[model samples]
Target: MDPATLIGIALAFIIVVVVNVMEGGNPMAMILIPPMLLVFGGTLVICLAGGTMGDAKLAMQGMVKAFTSPAPSAAQLVPELVTLADKARREGLLALEDYVADLDDPFLVKALTMAIDGTDPEELRDILEAEVHAKKAETKQAAKFWTAAGGYAPTIGIVGTVMGLIHVLEQLAQPEKLGHLIAGAFVATLWGVLSANALFLPLGARITRLGELEVAQMELVIEGVGALQAGSNPRLVAQRLRSLLPASQREEEAA
Candidate 1:
């Protein structure tokens, strides 16, 4: 699981609760049903209307995958690619076929399968590049579902705030209860803003980040498969693949 995602969410909630308590504010005062239903329900209504049901499902699945699935370890893939490069250079592209069934990553399997089938180097690049772009586009659409919700949330909160103000004005003759009514009305605004920033906005940002990581890993596959097809030396292939990583992660490959 993604510790950072979990920790960030937990910390946000903890800080808010602690501060509320420390300030002598009633933590329960924030729990109003109407404002919450308006912000959350309204956001979902617009998001679903804007995108397909499949897109909404994918977005939820994407969020779960982001938190639960570990990214492919490129450090491990480097060695595997080096081994493939050496075997291909020694025994030809067809020799790599022996390892294809054993490969776990479907992307790698497809790219290497094409290479073994004697696909032209440029054609191989085009095929893999197209797949990469298609996958990236799909993932991006999933993220847009959440981002659209995030964009709508704050504005929806303002609508709730206005509704609350209207309720307050309707009972304006009761001067003694005006302060309480005003505070209750503002609670809708709080729910909207907090839910947007704390939940939807952050969820969208994390989905985008996870998409970038996934695309980078797939690009590495393209490079690895290309190098194997080109008959580059094993060590040189390893070096080239290692260059795709950030400087900090590159050090782990060295070790």
Candidate 2:
């Protein structure tokens, strides 16, 4: 599992608590149960209401993926593609069938299998590209769910704050308790804004970024597979695939 998201979220909350204490506020005061439920629970149901059940399922999966999915490494695949290109060049595309089970990436395996089975290069490209497009659409929907939640969270928080303020107003006769009650009322607003910036929005962006990375990796595989099917030189295949990577990764590969 990727630790960056976990570490980042934990650090954000820690810093918030630390800063609250540094400002002479009791961190526990911000932990009001009513506001917590209103802000978080309300936001959740509202987001769910906005989307279908399938979208909700995708969003939950995306949330897990954001915290756990490893970043794709297209750089690593280049050498493997180059190796396949070399074998196909030396022994023909049929020779690659012997190596299919040894390949780890299902995407690469599928591409290589198709190539070895005498799939026309154009048809293979079309099929793989279609699959990539479908994946992009699915991931896009998942990320959209989180992005919608992030947008709704702050508004829900404000609603919670307003409700709390209504309750505070009812106790106006008790001037002695006004200050504490007012502070508690504002906790809804704090949680709303804090959760939006620190949690919901970040998760949405992370999911979007991960989707993009996966798509990029798949695109690289498509190019690699195309080169292999064409029986391109291993050196040319490596150069072509490396060109598709970031300059930093290309430099690392060269080293």
- Minimum summed lDDT over a 10-residue window in model 2 is located at 246-255
Best by TM-score: 2
Task: Give candidate 2's TM-score.
Answer: 0.96
Q: Write the per-residue lDDT of candidate 2 for residues 25-51, one digit (tens) a residue.
A: 899999889998988898889988988
lDDT per residue, candidate 1, 125-168, as tens digits? 99889988988887888878878888888889888888888888
What does the lDDT read for residue 55 in candidate 2? Answer: 88
Residue 162 of model 2 has an lDDT of 88
Best by lDDT: 2
Candidate 2 off by > 4 Å: none
Q: What is the overall TM-score of model 1 with all chains considered together?
A: 0.91
Which ranges in model 1 have alpha carbons more than 4 Å from their true place?
Answer: none
Model 2, CA-based lDDT: 0.89
lDDT of each model, Cα atoms only? 0.83, 0.89
